[model samples]
Target chain A: MQERLGKWLLSWPPLAYLVVFFLLPSLIMMFAAFRYPGDYGGLMPLTSEDPATGKLVLDITLDNWRDYLTLESFVRLVDEPLYIELFIKSLWYATLTTLICIAMGYPLAWLIARSPKKYRDLMLLLVILPFWSNFLIRIYAWMILLGPQSALSKAINLVVTAFGHEPVSLLFTPFAVIVCLVYVHLPFMVLPLYANLEKHDMALLDAAQDLGASAWQRFWKITWPLSLPGVYAGAALVFIPALGMFAVPDIIGGTEGIMIGNLIKQQFLETRDWPFGAVLSIMLTGGVLLMAGLAAAVGRGKQKAKQKHG
Target chain B: MAKRQSWWLWAAAALAYVFLYLPLVIVVVYSFNDSKLNAEWVGFTLDWYHKLFNNREMLVAARNSMVIGVVSALAATFFGALAGIAMHRYKLRLLPFLVLTPIAIPEILMGVSLLIFFVLLNVTLGMTSIILAHVAFCIGFVAIVVRARMQGMDNSLVEAARDLGATPWQAFRLVTLPQIMPGILAGGLMAFTLSIDDFVITFFTAGVGSSTLPLQIYSMIKIAVTPEVNAISTLLMVLTLCLIVLVSKVSPGALRAE
Candidate 1:
């Protein structure tokens, strides 16, 4: 029928795009991770390799997985003091950045959502304008600003001299890493919080106030509870990617500190260890998905509890 | 009433703004700094801007990024428009989750997998490959934005257009297109920005010689930071700002509308 044909045409384009480009490529790549290259740099099937050729003998062996799970490799990657220390450092940095973003963004979102219609656009623009630029450029700018001789450092030194205090080294540390991550991801945090906050029915707060509740009381009871979804959303948005971040640490974290993302990058590009790189990618992906899954479960549980209590 | 309302919120907001804009402000200022140190402000000069304009390599990278951006934006918009329509008009089971999986996948995994896939196929990575990669990720963004517009659309307009004996294409072109054009434009601009700004994925999928602006910047930074780079970044920031504004202005209620 013409109708059926029309419907098929309507859906085919997008479906084909997703299937061909996104899904197929990803599946192929995942499969490639399981095999080694042949003479033509093509993936060979299991049992197809000639014993004499020794060209990445593709026996569908568990060698790749075994290599990753070996005690030495495990010790090197996980038990190694440096990787564990850096992982902890990265976790805390991401945590601090997430907290800072929430602390900064929530009140701003509240202000924008509550402000008069005339000034709302101005406030939102201020919040989002920084994100308009490239993320790398922003971090690079931070490097310029926070470097020892930079204007910010110079200004702080001047003040420190005035007060007879020592000028602090703020750049090239965990402090700088957190600052950069918060700066870059702040808008992502703000936008979602703004969305959730703006959706709050003003009349509910009015009712809370009408019940002789103090302004702070109304905020704690009504506003805070209402915006918790946004807060969680904002925190997750900042925290998830911040953990896997590469450039910020590379540009600003200096030699002493590095993120796992940087390690993954090094493995792939600098080290030229494709198999190890694939394993690391899988691990990092697993970590992100695990965290996201936990967050979702917690969110659902909280919602269910709230429903029951209400 | 005066006692009940504290200026704490306002103060917090001001500090947050300061934290956010200080680096950007420094970047803009240092782009015109007379000296190369990027530390001290020697004097204002247009020398770096001039250098940026004269650099052929930088210009080539910028061109590559622009080409990728435009192609990806248009492709994403087209496919995303259809996906959005399918999600909205047709109640296809399991389609929503399928569309969303692309976003959930860590961008690094997506990048690595695609790299491996291209290598397996003996496909040389180039501008075309970059465009393909850009579109793959950008489609999800386009879908989300277009879906937002679709949700807000009143269905009656489409029905009325159909009732008036307009063909399906005519109905889409005349009624649906005009209504969602803002969303499409917004999505397209976002796609362009994201594509141009991307480095990591591009680094993985892009061929050895195919240097996007971000890739070039990445390599340059790896060598060493430069004030000339600052000047380039400042220009990029300004351009991105203009594009965001243009897109936002077109799409009223586009911000936080989703």
Candidate 2:
């Protein structure tokens, strides 16, 4: 009895707290998505006039849900090429960012993991320390660097003058947005990859080499396969948040780089279309969850197969 | 021959460090620049820092951020420690997964959801609501850290205490709490930093008159990039770095690569 009471005392507070503060809010938001938008930025209720008393009574209806579920919103989303283009563009940006992160992060992670033990923590700190700074300020730093009249641009322009070429515009462009995104998320990719790579058994490589396999062949057959979990984790870490990113694009992305996150922001703040924004939020959430699930499944499958073989 | 090839790896790592630090260095260096705008370099001056000190709104926003960060961290630590201990000590199914939902959900989704929730509840959006929203997300982080710590802890110590005639509360207080205290403290520090640096969720949940530091910096930047912003950014960066160092000191492997 005492143990059960102790368990209840330990568990119930956080469970109740989360249900009220976190889970309840999510449920409300999901429910609001199906209801008609109220005049004041929430769900609306149906109302009808009472016949005998001549008084109006409020009621709930599935009409708002039916309106959205009738294929209109989805069709509208399809017909609107801007939405489609933004979705595709966001995906392309995330993919490119993930690829760049892998290219940059893999080597860096390998170096840190392979570094002398005494200096390893310091090196990792160098990577993580800057992330402590405000993310917006970090993005703003890029703005300063890429500004047309800034020192970096002037130096580049000075070199261009020797060749009689024009100074290039760099700020407020898709290139700038991609650079910032990669800069922001590179650590996420590197950390997990480093965690995986650091534990790798070097003896396997030495054995493969002793068996007369080339370094490239050893990497492909042993190291790459072993690092698959980390690759998936790093990719997921970069890809999901990048897919839903708004602030980076909002700040650095010019007209050409608007994403779905920006669209959702506009709907809530500018358009004041709460239900539509909810729909977009739900879709983005669904996409992110799906990606995370797929990554988890793939990791499990690989582990199971490895267990079978080993 | 292998050493020669490995030099390329070292060079790539060097370049990566340079890539990461270059922007931060620019921000810090330009904070003292006499230039009002970011485009050009003027002679060094402390005018921006002076202006930052005199700015009332910035100071208020900073105070608000600190208060919210501290309060939310405390709240999250208390609740998270309880849940984490329970989950570790008992066979409570389904609760762990539910706790993870807040972290898994996108920040924008969480932000909008909280906004809608507050509006529906007829609660005025202010510091209280913002703190609640922060605590909601921060609990999961703290819970995860504490749970990891508890899972690795030996159970015999608590059993030994109980066998020696200590009550359940006394056993936990004397044995379990001290063992997991570092994890709780580390989780609190992380939660504090996360709250202080948060922008998106705070943006949606914070209505008029309750802007946090990041929100303030963002609005200021939207209007224009001034040297004052750089000074404030440098200050915030220093504060965060100090906290991270303290966190590392508190728990050696807390911020390890994993």
> RMSD of each candidate?
3.9, 2.9
| CAPRI docking class of candidate 2 | medium
Q: How does residue B192 of candidate 1 score in lDDT?
A: 90
Tell how far residue A259 is off in model 2, in angstroms. Answer: 1.3
* Candidate 1: tens digits of C-alpha lDDT, residues A13-100: 8788778767787666545444443434333334444778866654445665542233333335566577667666777888888998
| B102 Cα displacement, candidate 2 (Å) | 2.2
- Candidate 2 matches the true fold with a TM-score of 0.93
- Candidate 2, position B172, lDDT: 90
How far residue A94's Cα lies from its native spot in candidate 1, in Å, is 1.9
- Residue pair clashes in candidate 2: none
Off by over 4 Å in 2: A40-42, A45-58, A61-75, A155-167, B1-5
Model 1 residue A180 lDDT?
A: 89
